[model samples]
Target: MQLLILMVVLLALTTFGFRLGRGRAIAASGNNPRLLHSLPRYHGYYVALWSGLPALFLIAAWLMLEPSLLHSAVMSALPADLQGLSEERLALVYNEVRNVARYGHVPSTDAVGQAAAGYIGVRDTVFLSVAALALALAVAGLAFARKRIEVELRARNRVESVVKVFLVLASLAAIFTTIGIVLSLLFESLRFFQAVSIFEFLFGTQWSPQMAIRSDQVGSSGAFGAIPLFTGTLLISGIAMLVAVPLGLLSAIYMSEYAAPKFRSVVKPLLEILAGIPTVVYGFFAALTVAPFFREIGASMGLSVASESALAAGMVMGIMIIPFVSSLSDDVITAVPNSLREGSYGLGATKSETIKQVVLPAALPGIVGGVLLAVSRAIGETMIVVMAAGLAANLTANPLEAVTTVTTQIVTLLVGDQEFDSPKTLAAFALGLVLFTVTLALNVVALSIVNKYREKYD
Candidate 1:
């Protein structure tokens, strides 16, 4: 509530400064915008930026640093015995103090209640002091900006320069974030590799990852072979692609080349609606409806099939990903130049022949791109696989067998509270790094295909 009120106050002041700055600029130019170096609105915007930006940056920095500073101060003021406690115990005490201060919780002892009171006093004082400083700086900026506003001032240039700097900072932030993610995954995977052989992880056929707590425990050293995981992931994703690609491409073709405009409009939205449905809903469908149905069908045929099989999960995943392929393919096919079709027809070619030879070839790059995206989606899917495909990492090409994908295993490994020092927890990062590498390789392959077949038109 306090932060919101501060924001409202700052916003109101910024607006008032904008109006005042614009009025001052016009008055300086004798009420003639043509006489001024920049428009009145530019002067207004320039002052508004000055009045708001610094305070916002200050608030953001303070909020980020506040918790650590508060923790240090409160811990230093604690009894010497409490201060000497282990780091974990001290952290818990700090959390208890914050809870007492915020929630009016009854502390175990009077010392805790007093600490909480002191924390509240310190927090409120610092907050108010910072808020006052922000307002002061905002007012000073507004005054300086208004004074600088004149016929000779280039307000537009100054505002645009600030915007350009903001854009550069935003780009650098994104780049640094990506670098951080890669480094974290790499470092954690390295730690995991220190415990398990990379060769065994990559090639050994076994897939168990249970790490024993004691030497006497059964399965003391768990199998970390990832071949079964890789196999299962490929099997499921391949099945999904087999189901999605032909249906999606054929539907897209029919819609783009044959359907009436009204029919096309209605059908396209209906297809895209599949994409809007939540993945969890699809997982439910796969688990409750599709899996049982498939199991019964297999039983009737006197064929063995697991209740939780890859086929059910893969089929449902394909249904979820159909829009990725059909929507993009339809758009690309529609975008193909009509001149090619006309030329093919002029050569006495039929409509189907023209589509097959001229239209499809022209749109091949985009179709390939869409298929690549669908493949990625299928590979990354977890909910449906978890619900319908059991988490038994079986190395089999048969879709009827229970299997698990890399993503499913990653989620399972990190589902609850875990000690990061253990190989089991760190294995998740290794799986993630491998998944990232595979995704990058797929992208490189897709880019090569797209560049090779990309068509240029005059």
Candidate 2:
């Protein structure tokens, strides 16, 4: 609550500074914005940045350091026996203190109660001091900016430089985060490959990853074959793409080239609403409705179909992905130059011929991008496949058989408390590494196609 109040106060001060700076700039220009070096708004933004940025930096730094400072202060006052406890025990004690201080929990001991009280007091004092210092910094910044605001001040350039630096920092943060993920995956996958052969994981057919706890137990050497998982993933994703591409592309063509304006607006939003629906809901639909329906149909035809089949999951996943393809393809087709269509028509072509030969060709790049994006979504999906398709990593091309994808296995492997050093847990990372590589490859292929075949227009 104190932090919230401090933030609100800082916001009010920043807003006030903006208005004051703009008013001062106008007054300095003899009540004429035209005489100023930059717009009055830029001066306002300059003052706002000055008022907020330093205090924001201070608040961020204080928040980051506050926990450690409080911990050190409290630990220094702890009893020798408590201080001498193991790291794990000390962590538990610290957690107890925090709970007592923050959540009004009953402390188990007098030392804990006293430590919690001191923790609260120190935290409150530090927060109050930081809040005061932040406000002072904000006020100082506002005063400095107010003095610097003049007819000749280049507020726009300074503000834009700050924004450019912020953008660079944000980009670097994202790049570093991606690098961290790739390195973590690479390290864990290398560990997994040490325990299990990469060749067997890649090419072996059997994939029962249940490891016996004891050496004397049966099935002690768990099979680590990933071909079944890969095959199942491909089968489901391929089935989904087969169902999605035709429907999504044809809908895009109809909406972009043939539908009336009112009808198009109404129908487009309705179609896109499919994208907004939660995948869990689609999973439910697939499991409870679509799967059973397919099973009954197969039974009536004297054919066998698993209750949890790839066909059921893939079909529902395709339905969920329809909006991705339709929306992008519609935008790309609509953006095609009208001159191309007109030229096609002038050369004795019909409307359908003009669209098929000119507009579609021009829009192919975006359509391929959209389709590949949908394929990636299909591959990455977990909840729908988990609920609809059984976790039987059957290496089969028949969509009527039960199957599982890499993402489903990754989730299953990681759930619950398990030793990370075990092959079972590490297998998830190997699966993730493969999934990431496949997605990256798809993106590279999509980019290559877009760059090579894209039609240039005026």
Candidate 3:
């Protein structure tokens, strides 16, 4: 509530700054546009940025740093015994203090309650002081900016420089975030590897993570083999790609080449609606409808099938991803220059022959890129597989049997309050790392294909 109030006040001040600065610029320029260095609106934006940006930035910084600083201070002021406690115990103690402060209820410990009260007092004091300082700075910035708005002042350049810096920071944020995720995955995976051999994890076929609770437990050998998982993921994802590629590409080709504009507009959105449906809904459909249907058909054919089979999951997942392939391929195929089609017609070639020989070849790179993206989506899928394909890591290529995926296993291992030190929990991280590596490798291959084919056209 307090933060929201601060934001509202700052926004009002910024608006006031815009009006006052524009008025100041007009008064200085004698209400003549040609006399000013930059437009009056730019000067207004300049003052608004001055009035709001510094205070906004400072308030954000203070909010992020306040909890840690106050927690440290509260800890320091505790009794000798509490101060001497281990870090973990001290953390628990601080949590109790926070609870007391928030609820204003007596804690089990009186000392902790007093400290919590003190924390509340100090926090409120600091918050009020900072809000006051922010308002003061905003006022000062507005006054300075309004005074600086002259016929000679370059407000446009100053505002654009700030905009340029903001854009650069936004780009750097994405790059740095990618770096951070890779580093975290790598470190946790290294920890898991320290406990379990990477060679065993990659090659061994058995997949039990809970059989070995303790290293010294009798007849309890822990198995962390990931080959079964790899095969299962590949099998299901390959099935999905097989279903998606031909259907999606053909739909794209037909829509782009044969359909009229009005018909295309109506049908395209209805087709893309599949992409908006939640994966959990797809999972429900697979589990309740598709799985049983497949089982009955297989039973009639004298073939036994599990209630939850990879075929059902992979088929539903393929249907879900078809929009991805179709939409991108449609755009790419439509982007092919009309001159090529015109020349093909000039050569007395049929539309089907031209599409098959020239158009598809021209759009192959983009189509491949879309297909690769759909393949990644299929591999990363979890809910549909979990509901339609049971969590049995059977090392087989058959799509009609129950098989689990790396994503499903990762969710299963890390769902509860399991300790991170256990191999079961750590296994999730290792799986994530491998998944990341594989996805990165796939992206590299896709980029290479795109670049290779792109150069031919250029």
Top-scoring candidate (lDDT): 2
Question: Whose TM-score is higher: candidate 1's or candidate 2's?
Answer: 2
Global fold similarity of model 1 (TM-score): 0.95
| lDDT, candidate 1, at 410 | 96
Task: For model 1, state the Cα shift of residue 91 in Å.
Answer: 1.4
Q: To one decimal, what is the Cα RMSD in angstroms of model 1 from the true structure?
A: 2.0
In model 2, state the lDDT of residue 318: 88
Ranking by lDDT: 2, 1, 3
Candidate 3: Cα lDDT at 181 = 94
Which stretches of model 2 miss by more than 4 angstroms?
213-218, 451-455
The Cα local distance difference test for each model comes to 0.89, 0.92, 0.88
Worst 10 residues of 3 by lDDT: 211-220
Cα lDDT of model 1 by residue, 1-458, tens digit: 89899999999999998998899999999988899999999999989998999889889988998898888778888988788899999888889999999999999777778889889988998899889989998998899898889898999999899999999999999999989999999999999999999999999888778887688865479788999999999988998898889899999999999999999989989999999999999999999999999999999999898998989988999898889889988988988888889999999999999999999989988899878877877888888887788888898999999999999999999999999998888999999999988887777777676556554542
Model 2 Cα lDDT, one tens digit per residue, 66-143: 989999999998999899999999999999999999999999999999999999999999999999999999999999
Candidate 3's TM-score = 0.93
Model 3: colliding residue pairs: none
Model 2's lDDT to the true fold?
A: 0.92
